[model samples]
Target: MFVVSAPSGAGKTSLCRELIDSIPDLRQSISFTTRNIRDGEQDGVDYFFTQTDSFQRMIAEQLLAEYAEVHGNYYGTSLETLNTAEAEGVDLLLDIDCQGAAQLKKNYRRGVFIFILPPDFAELKKRLYNRGTDHEDVIQRRLENAEQELLQAPWYDYLVINDDFQSAKKKLMAIITAERCRMSRTTYLLNNFTVKGDK
Candidate 1:
């Protein structure tokens, strides 16, 4: 499993989408949220939009793998989603916030945690404004939250500096591919390739 966390407007969503499109067996984990569904967003595609009461029910039932309240709305990843991915032996990608990422780390220690960073604060602000999706106050709030989010980068396993889209994508792909090639994950591939005939 892979957990990616970034402040808003860091292009993490685009990067995750591209990664899923490029990789054959990777699947993105759909999260449930109590926030309003934005325009052009499908209920199950972008997020599982639900009411606050429903989210509370989910929490009470222990149905969520990890959840957090961000900007006054609750967002959570269902345990069922991760279970399905593991059952199918497919790699899963989670586009989550810093709080969600931290909770996921506690529960899924083996997951590859990545922090996506914008080139700098100025670039981040530019991207936020260019998107033109939020109100002036909302944008400012996001920027302020971003500073605190960036501070948590050191807690992650890897950092992808999103200076350029292509370069950032390459770094993300490298991280995933490299993790797949690790001895721990590839032990089965080398099981029968020992120095058998060299004795």
Candidate 2:
């Protein structure tokens, strides 16, 4: 599994979309959220929109691998989805916030953790304004939150600075490719090899 986290207005979402579309077998892990569905978002595709009661039940049942409350809404990843992906030998890409990513780290350490940063604070602020999805106060809050989230970058395995869209996309793709090609992960190939030297 690949867990990616970025501050608001950062390009992690767009970058992840590029990866899943271009790479066969790389599936996105659509999370469950209590937030209302936004324009252009589809249920079960972007997120599994649920009632707060149902979301609380998932937490009570321990069905969620990791969960967090962001912007007064609950977001979570289901352990069932993760288990099914692993059983099917398919990779999963998770686009979540730092809060959720931290919880996932304790539960699933094998995932590749990637942190996305904007080119600079000025650029981040500009992006937030251009998004026009949040209110002025909400945008300021996100800026404040971005400062805190940036501090968590060192904890991730990869730090990707999203200066240029295509460049950042290529870098993420490279990271995923390298992780998938790790010798330990591809040891299944050894089963087909007949070696002359024995350990």
Candidate 3:
């Protein structure tokens, strides 16, 4: 499993979409949330929209692998989703926030955690304002949250900065490719190439 996390307006979603589309066997784990759906967002697609009570119940039942409340709403990934992907030998890509990623890492030892950041604080602020989706107060809150999130970069397995879209995408793709090609996972290929007349 791979966890890709970043603050709002950091281009994580766009990068994730490109990664999923490009990778042949990658599956994105859809998260469930109690947050209200924003414009153009659909239930079961953007998120498995549910109520706070239901979310809490799932947590109590230990059905969720990790859960957290953000911006006054709850969000989590179901264990069933993770297990299904693992059973099928599919790479699971989780696009979650830093807190959720940390929670997942605690339980899943083999997960690859990648934290994406914007080019710089100035650019990050500009991107947030350009989105025009939040009021000044809300934007300020997001900026504050972003600063904290950025500080957690060292906790991730890899840190990717969105300085250039294509360059960052290439770096992300290379990382996934390199991981898949690890010696332990690709031993079969090595065995197939041995010389027939070898001792």
Pick by TM-score: which candidate is best? 1
Model 1 steric clash pairs: none
- For model 1, residues 1-199, the per-residue Cα lDDT tens digits are 9999999999999999999999877999999999999889999999999999999999999999999998789999999999999999999999999888998898887799999989889999999999998999999999999999988889999989999999999999999999999888988887687758867
Candidate 2: pairs in clash: none
Residue ranges of candidate 1 with Cα displaced over 4 Å = 194-199
The per-model lDDT (C-alpha) reads 0.93, 0.92, 0.90
Model 2 poorest 10 in a row by lDDT: 190-199
What value does the lDDT take at residue 125 in candidate 2?
Answer: 97
Model 2 alpha-carbon miss at residue 32, Å: 0.5
Q: Across residues 1-199, which tens digit of lDDT does each residue of candidate 3 receive?
A: 8899898888999999999999988998999999889999999888999998999999999999998888789999999999999899999999998889889889878888999989889998999999998899988998999988888889899989999999999989988998898877788987766866756
**RMSD score of candidate 3 (Å):** 1.8
Q: State each candidate's clash count.
A: 0, 0, 0
TM-score of every model versus the real structure: 0.95, 0.94, 0.93
Question: If ranked by TM-score, best first, what sequence of candidates would result?
Answer: 1, 2, 3
